[model samples]
Target chain A: MQREVMFAGFGGQGILLIGNILAHTAMEEGYEVAWVPSYGPEMRGGTAYCLVVISDRPIGSPIIRNPMHLVAMNHPSLEKFAPMVKPNGVVVINSSLIHIGSDRDDVDELLVPANDIANDLGSIKVANIVALGAFVARSKIVDFEVLRKCVQEQFSSKEKLIPINMAALEEGKKVAQIK
Target chain B: MGKILMKGNEAIGEAAIRAGCLNYFAYPITPQSEVAEYLSRRMPEVGGVFLQAESEIAVGNMLFGAAGCGARVFTTSSSPGISLMSEAISYISSAQLPVVFVNIVRGGPGLGGILPSQADYFQATKGGGHGDYRLLVMAPASIQEAVEMVMTAFPLAEKYRNPVMILGDGLIGQMMEPVEFPEHLRTEPSNKDDWATNGMDTRKSSKPNLVKTLFLNAEKLEEHNVILKAKYDRMKREEVRYEPYNTDTDYQALIVSFGTMSRVCRTVIDDLKAEGFETAMIRPQTLFPFPEEPIKQAALKESCKVIISIELNMGQMVEDVERSVQGGRPVHWYGKAGGDVPTPEEIIDVIKSFVS
Candidate 1:
């Protein structure tokens, strides 16, 4: 199986982190994965993004033109990448900040109030994880348990932050399933 | 070793450490600055030397001094920085010093933008510096290959006593993938005791070993050129490497490409096969040798109709492809330059025109 995902957001929103987490989980599952970030000067405070391609076979190009999934964490991301999602693919949007909606009807849209959900869980930094959990729940691209374990390993240095991020993940999954 | 998720730039640093490279002097440039950044922290831990030179010019001279001592030394740069180092590179070649340098190429000509590009094809294959010299250029298509190429480059450089280059695009440096450094490929620290200028105490002979490139006599310079040409001749005979896909079948057309562009062509050929059109592709793993014989043999296949070159540069490797075929069949080119990378669909569109 092959899945290409584009995660896009503002520079400080952990867009690249989410993509990296997903790629690590896929690698743990014995799949070949590639993660390519938008490099150069524009990456400082601009629309930071990354493309993750996971496959059972060898990957050809790391550049993704039309991704099977797009996780947009802000309004401009939604405006830029929503139209590029493949037909019958999934577009997961953070509903808290994005006031506009994707006009495409052929693709599936999973709207998660990631920022609100993380704020309710007492931290805004976990919103990217919330969006990631919702994308996992909706698309079933990778096992949720593997993703959680990867996140835990990433933050193993800080033991206290793990529980809240785990809670935020569950909250996002619950919201995604209800929608 | 186990698999580790690594960016291409960081992997090059780690691989150099594994390969027993102790001295690294470089000037930072876009798309490849991470190589220097990663080594700055890593070199100290391994008890190696890592210095950020004032400029590419100074870095080139530093590399010359380090390598002349028979040390395994290397540097990384992009197109413009590589251009600045060409003067010292020629001197290093004439002195027969073994140094490995990596060029994560960007868009060229002048101070170009920091994006993935293959516009340095001619600069790499043909000598970018003055005089008669050639660098053993290896272009890798994947992150794993990039790591392997960096590991093997040290030995190859020392064996030939000539400079070696790893030519990759910005995409290869920016992309992240799973990689493992093979233990067998990790070489012991190179033995520079033979001709190294470690002073009179370390020398076995009473006479001093002079390490100069100047040959004031025209006959002496001609003799040096003949020796360099002989070494290059051996490299071509033994080290030319290329991979052929679907050439076993009676393919209709052949596509010639190298580096990341060759990976995209793999997908294009697969799609064409699914559509009941069989094609072949030749991916040159070593760009300096140019893999001319393989391209000629593939073009001579009775079923082969046309040969096309798809590149990221505006028809740089295309000239090499045409020369390889030697007018045996029609050779065409489809490419773009100045930071624009061609998509697989774009390559497919061009291949479809050839089909009709």
Candidate 2:
């Protein structure tokens, strides 16, 4: 199965990092993956996005026009990419910042209060990771264990922060499981 | 071999290091600046020389100086920066020095934008400077291919004793993919005792070597040109690299493209195949010593009704495609310049016009 996921938010929200971590995890799972960033002047405070394509076969084009999944971390991102998600695909949104819900009835929408969950876990910065956890849990694109490994590997540089991020992942998974 | 994900620019830097190229000098430019940035920290760790020259001109000369002294040296730049390095590149070509350079080409006429574009197709394959010369230009489609080609570039440069270029666009430089540094592609620099000017006393023959392009004598200059011509011909004969897809079967249209643009075409070809439209593709791995034979054969296929050349520039590579097609059939061109990369759907729309 081929899964193309787009992660979008502001630059400082670690949107690109989530894409990278997912790419790494997918590759580790023996899938071909490509991560492409939307790079330009708009990357400052404006909307930043990265596309991650994970496929069992060799990936052809890294540029995804309509992704199978959308992870929107902010209002702008949700508004921008929500409609572009393919019908019968998955849309995971951070409801803490995005008040408007997706109108599409064909796709599955899993709304997680990512910031609130991350804050409850201690830090709000890992909200992206929380969204990622929610994504994997609801979509089942990757296993919870694989997502955990990805979180550990990504935060390996700052060992102290690994535990909190892992906690964020757990919180995200719990909320997603209920949905 | 474990698969590690890395960006194309950083992978190129790592590949150069793995290939045992210990000298790097370059000026930063967007879409390709990461190569220099990665090497800045990496070269020091590997005991290699890394310098951010004051300008691209200075970087080109630094490459010339190091290459003359028998160092495996290289540099990276985008379109405008590459223009600045053309003079030194021509000199290196004339002097028969082995240097490797990567142009992660961006859009141009002049400082166009930082986004990916294959505008440097003419500048790279054709002689950019004022001389008859060719850089064995390699264009890699994906990050892994970029890594492998970069590793192979060093040995090819030394074997031919000519400047070798890896021509990529912003997509190839920015996209992240899984890559492995194969042990076999790792090569040591050949001993340059014969011609390198690494202190004349270091040679067993006790002879001094002067590396310069200034052959004032008419006969000597003619002889040098003849030698370079022979090398280029040999490269054409032996080093033409390309990949063809769905060419074995009869197809309605043949699409010729290179670098990252070809990947999108591949996806479109698959889509067209599913939709019952016969389509084939030819992706050139080497832009210089271009795979003209394969392209011509693909274009000449009996079922092919139209030949389309897709590029990121305003049809720069299409000229070469036309020459390869040799007017046997109509050659069409479609492209978007100044940092706009066309989507598979966009290319599909173009292909539809050809068939319909």
Candidate 3:
């Protein structure tokens, strides 16, 4: 079982962080994982993206032109990557920032107000964690408990921010369930 | 051992550390700059030396300096920057230094774009620098292979007492993959007492050890080249690596590819198999040795009618394929240069036309 996912947004939107968390969770679960981020001059304030591939076997190619899942955090990301999602794949879009919705009928689309959920949870910066929670709840690609552990491990050094991010993830899962 | 999800550049750095490379010197170049960046952070943690040299030339020279001291050393650079390092590479090869250099290739004959390209095949295998010297060029198709190759390169260099090169393009340098660290990290051999310029002890006879490539005598230079040739001969016999895919069947065409191009070729071959066309691929893992024996044997098969050489460059490895086939079969070349990687469809189209 090989799944290719891309998390895309502006540099500060924590797209890379989300990809890293997913990759780490997959690794912890004893799966082969690859997390590749876009570098070069395109990574400053411009649209930053990372490709994560989780597989039961060794990954052959880490560069993916058409990913199975796309988590779009902004309008530009939604516009750019929504159409590239594979048929029968899933797309989780942030409704608070993405102005347009995907028109494809072949794939599943989940539009969550991740930013609103994070803000409601008292930290707008946890929007990415919210998106991560929504992705986990809807797709079940990885266990939620494993993902939470990965989150804690990622933010373990920063003891204070852990609770807020955990709250943000729970809030995201709740909103995603209702939507 | 445990698995780690690492970026390609970072894996290379970590592999070097595990391979007992205690010194790394490099200058920043796109797509490959992360190698130095990763080393800068991780080297100090491992009690190794990581120096960001002012220029690629200086970095190459610094490698020479460290290797001259009989320390395990390495450097990383991209295409144009690698070109700047050619002079020092020649010197290192002529002097028979045991060091590793990584060329995370980008596009072009000039300051090309920061994208993956295999166009450096000629520059790498055909002696980019002056003189008749050869580097043991290894091309890795995956990030895991990239890490493994860097780990293996140090020992190979030490065994042959010559420079070894990890020739990867931008994709391999930028892609991420899961890698397991080697089980045992062997301590690098301490040859300093015999070869280095450390001050002599009074217990030993008074003699200075000077490492230089300047053998002004013509006959002596000829002897040096002959010794270099012998080392390369032994490497060709022992170190040639190639992977054969679906070669058991009667293939209408055989595809030769390497690095990332070989991965794309595998996808193309799978598509062709679904469409009822029998095709196979021969991937050269080591570029310098050329894996000529296997390629020649495959080409000589009566069932294999056409041989196609696919690359990211415009037929750089084609020359080697032609020599391997020895005109027994028609060897075709298909590629896109200047940082453009040929898609699976593009490669399949070329193969379809050739088979027809």
Which of the two candidates, 1 or 3, achieves a greater DockQ against the reference? 1
Candidate 2, residues B206-314: lDDT per residue as tens digits? 6788898988999999999999999999999999999999888789899998988899899999888888887999999999898888888888888889999999889
Best of the candidates, lDDT: 2
lDDT of 1: 0.89
What's the TM for model 3? 0.95
Pairs in clash, predicted candidate 3:
none
On lDDT, the stronger of 2 and 3 is 2
Counted clashes in each candidate structure: 0, 0, 0
Superposed Cα deviation of residue A45, candidate 2 (Å): 1.9
Report the C-alpha lDDT of model 3 over A1-179, residue by residue, as the tens digit: 78988899888989999999999998889888878777655847789888888989766555667899989998888889988899988799899988788888998888888888888888789999999998888888899999999899889999999999998888767766875
Ranking of models by lDDT: 2, 1, 3
Model 2 residue B273 lDDT score = 87
Q: Which pairs clash inside model 2?
A: none
Docking class of 1: medium
Give the alpha carbon lDDT tens digit for every residue of B114-170 in model 3: 788998999999999999999999999988899889999999988877889999987
What are the per-residue Cα lDDT tens digits for candidate 1 across A4-123? 999999999999999999999999989999998988668566899999999999997667689999999999999999999999888998999998788899988988999999998999
Off by over 4 Å in 3: B190-194, B199-208
| Root-mean-square deviation per candidate | 1.4, 1.3, 2.1
- Across B152-246, the per-residue lDDT of candidate 1 in tens digits comes to 88999988888999999888998899999876534433556665676767656676766789999999999999999999999999889888988
TM for every model, in the order presented, reads 0.98, 0.98, 0.95
